[model samples]
Target chain A: MFYLLGLGILCIAFLFIIGLYNLDFKYLFMISAPAEKITAAVIIIGILNCIISILFFFGVGYLREAVKAFMEKKIFQLKTVLYFKRSGIYLSSCATLGFISRSLAIIYLRVDNNGSGFGLGYSSLLIFMLICGLCFILISHVLKESVALKEENDLTI
Target chain B: MSIYINLDKVLEDRDMKSHELAEKIGITRANLSILKTGKAKAVRFSTLEAICEVLDCQPGDILEYKAD
Candidate 1:
């Protein structure tokens, strides 16, 4: 039950990000810089967004495969383990890229860097992704043990 | 690990084949092979009973425990 709720929240956050992308962070920055800087910022942010989107989609694909394996009761197999582990790595990569890009953007845009940290909005999602990624890796380890036990049990007369 | 299967000895004594015992017990030949090779992790009571019934022997005659 809680797992479903968590996934729901993650999906909603993902949709919120898409909406934010559609809005295009132009207004989010209160900088009154020259046209050249503005164009450069747009290009940089666009490229970063593109990379992050690709990684996020790959992570989602791997997670969907893992979920399908669970639904089919094939969790005690190496294929399921591979799905979970790959998803975990992709998600962790997405979170890392998000953090690095956001931090660099903030520094480049000169957006009030008084040593304060990120806001509660997107940072929370990034943190959640990192945690979920680690959790998936852990679940994969547990499933590895389950696979061994299942093999042993099946061989038992 | 201390528990062992002595099914082969009893089968040889009765001049019975592994496939014959397996068919009698309604189990696959591969499963019976696992048992004969001493690779099975555990045995089911129903299967043990079936094997004993087919071989006309006691459970003790088929299983032996040796401390390692």
Candidate 2:
């Protein structure tokens, strides 16, 4: 949760700094017009992301528990695998949506006849999205490895 | 990194089922299974204590030294 919150704050702060640097106050305000809308969308998406992250964390626990359960010939705990799969789905969608939103913002800036500043803003947003996308990919890989390890342990036991 | 668990042999010697041991030790069968399979990263002293108490044995009876 802290990581997500920190990332969100950092992204917003970076956007604000870029906006200030470009003096694209008008565009910023124009973007702000959709601020509530974008925020609403992000809020919904963020909530979903939160839920998914939580499920992912719990999925690890479940996987461990399931392995033990299976080894003892006890009840199979499917919750971990289910939660893990769902988290993967949710994470992918979130990343895609984030990329799309960033792309749309860049496109909006390109078409707008504001100033050269708009170009800078667009580039900054693009870079930000790229960084974020890379981070998410790395995170996904880490999660995948963890899940694989748990599965391997389950199989061996 | 290579702690060896002798839980299987202990259970065998005691003629106690894993589920029964788990119940006696106040842990879920799943957790006991983790311990038995050596998948657990760490074991609490309290849990070890419980297991020893239930099995009427020492920690060495359940765990062994294994140089990694």
Candidate 3:
């Protein structure tokens, strides 16, 4: 995903360079200067979103494992685990918002450019972010439930 | 939910301290406390087996079921 984001950013930069040079294109889908600028901004936002999303993924994994270990009554190393889990939830939320904003920016640029068809770029990105958001929500719920179960078990034992 | 753990009775019968048992099992005293308090969600099969072997008792003698 990060690679895709980087590629998109590079594509936008190339477009901007071409636009600045006032290069004539025989290609059917040529973008103008203003449109290129907008695309570049969107791509930059997309890159940021990807970076956050990657971090969130690692965070979710760490949280899930910590929760599982906690449930198993492994309490020796809990403080750090709890910290990571909390931070992961916050990062995931931020990544979701970033992805949404980037997608909207891309859509706005497309419309401004008088691009006839809806491009696959923005729609795919929106879908990916939505899926990631849902996954993170599910992960949070699972971790919460696991923690509750561990507490209950501890109380009973 | 309330669960029953008979670890205290087994430890008493075996003449073992919580810290000593924890040291033998290679787990922390806090974890042993959690197990004794019945606050642990799950126990590993290996750990359970080790406890039973050390205490010369069955799992049924150490744990009992209770409804929430």
Lowest lDDT 10-residue stretch of candidate 3 chain B: B37-46
**TM-score against native, each model:** 0.67, 0.41, 0.39
Instruction: Give per-residue CA lDDT, model 2, range B1-68, as digits (tens).
Output: 57899999988999999999888878788878888878887788898898888889999898898887
* Candidate 3, B1-68: lDDT as tens digits: 36588999889888989999888877788888988886677788888887888788899999888887
| Model 1 regions more than 4 Å off | A1-10, A13-16, A19-24, A27-35, A38-46, A111-120, B1-13, B23-27, B36-68
- Scoring the B chain of model 1 against the true B chain gives a TM-score of 0.95
TM score of chain A per candidate:
0.74, 0.33, 0.37
DockQ of 3: 0.20
Model 2 segments beyond 4 Å from truth? Answer: A1-121, A134-157
Q: Which candidate ranks first by DockQ, i.e. highest?
A: 1
RMSD of each: 5.7, 13.4, 10.7
Ranking by TM-score: 1, 2, 3
TM-score, structure 3 vs. true: 0.39
Query: Candidate 1's residue-wise lDDT over B1-68, tens digit each?
Result: 78888998999999999899999999999999998888898899999999999999999999999999
- Please list the C-alpha lDDT of all candidates, in the order they appear: 0.78, 0.57, 0.58
List, residue by residue over A14-122, the lDDT tens digit for candidate 2.
6534543453344345446765544444444344434533543343344345444435654323443443344444434434553454444445444342335433454
Best by lDDT: 1
